[model samples]
Target: MIREFFKHLPASVDPQTRDLAEQQLVGYACTRRPDDFAPLVAHLDSILSPDGDYDEDEDEDGKPKPKKRRDAFFYL
Candidate 1:
């Protein structure tokens, strides 16, 4: 099932990122049960989404503030 999820990842994702994601997924699968799949998928979806919550304030050069990476293992 986790393999299926990795297969479905976006093609635009770079090889390095995809490989890292696969490793992360495999680690998650090892530590979790079958029933945890739904939440795992949802978590992956959130990270993969291009749209993210950002502050209205701009950086010194006027670009939008970058979003910070959240801890993926928070839910656990």
Candidate 2:
């Protein structure tokens, strides 16, 4: 949906501005399902990056921490 939003954004708006808006929207969606989205959310910057896949430090155990899982409809 956000991709479509940016695709249909006004021509007057700059690409950078549109990208920021898309990121904000995606961020909101991620917040809404942090656990479900955590894998993607954790990689959001990379996902949004032009080159993709930035380097990130591992946790103390040198393992990527798993996202906490929660029911998708928990809030309802």
Candidate 3:
């Protein structure tokens, strides 16, 4: 799966790089069917965490609490 592939890749990769890759992939899909990319758009939205207040503390798993989601989605 793409998620697992990403997980196995170097974690040091910049987030912007990941975002660019996603955008390119979505763009590629749009080229195949001009009128039916809505579902793919929704799936992209689901990958992102929700916005607003977040805890700065780390969880028991030592992971930082999820931060408030940003406006990564843009309408053009």
Candidate 4:
């Protein structure tokens, strides 16, 4: 697993294995997924800083609300 690779990467005794883990980490880090980010953007508003953004469903001012911007997220 990636966590195992990461654990060994920092202090592995074998040079070849360490090099392999480094290469694998790079490959995983660069990969991207395709999906809209409204859900995450909304959620991150809480995760990044609690007492988050405006209510998505409410429109007290009578103007249409803007959509949340999409962003990348890694499973690791």
Q: Which candidate's lDDT is highest?
A: 1
C-alpha lDDT values of all predictions: 0.64, 0.50, 0.50, 0.42
Output the lDDT of residue 53, model 3: 36
How does candidate 2 fare on TM-score?
0.37
TM-scores of the models, in the order given: 0.54, 0.37, 0.31, 0.28
Tens-digit lDDT track of model 2 for 2-76? 453443344555678667766776777757664564444334433444333223546799987554332222222
Candidate number of the best TM-score: 1
Sorting all predicted structures by TM-score, with the top scorer first, yields 1, 2, 3, 4
lDDT of 1 by residue, 1-76 (tens): 5555555555666889777877888888788876685587657856864443334678899898876443333233
- lDDT of candidate 3 over 1-76, digit per residue (tens): 2342244334444799677756755575667453355445445434442222344679899999786443333333
Candidate 2 segments exceeding 4 Å error: 33-76
- Flag clash pairs in model 2: none
The alpha-carbon RMSD values of the candidates against the true structure, listed in the order shown, are 8.9, 12.0, 9.1, 15.5
**Whole-model lDDT, model 1:** 0.64
When sorted by lDDT, best at the front, the candidate numbers are 1, 3, 2, 4
Candidate 2 global CA lDDT score: 0.50
Q: lDDT at 52 for candidate 2? A: 31
- Candidate 4 residue lDDT tens string, 14-76: 677556545644564456332332243334333433433333564678876774443334442
Cα lDDT of candidate 3 equals 0.50
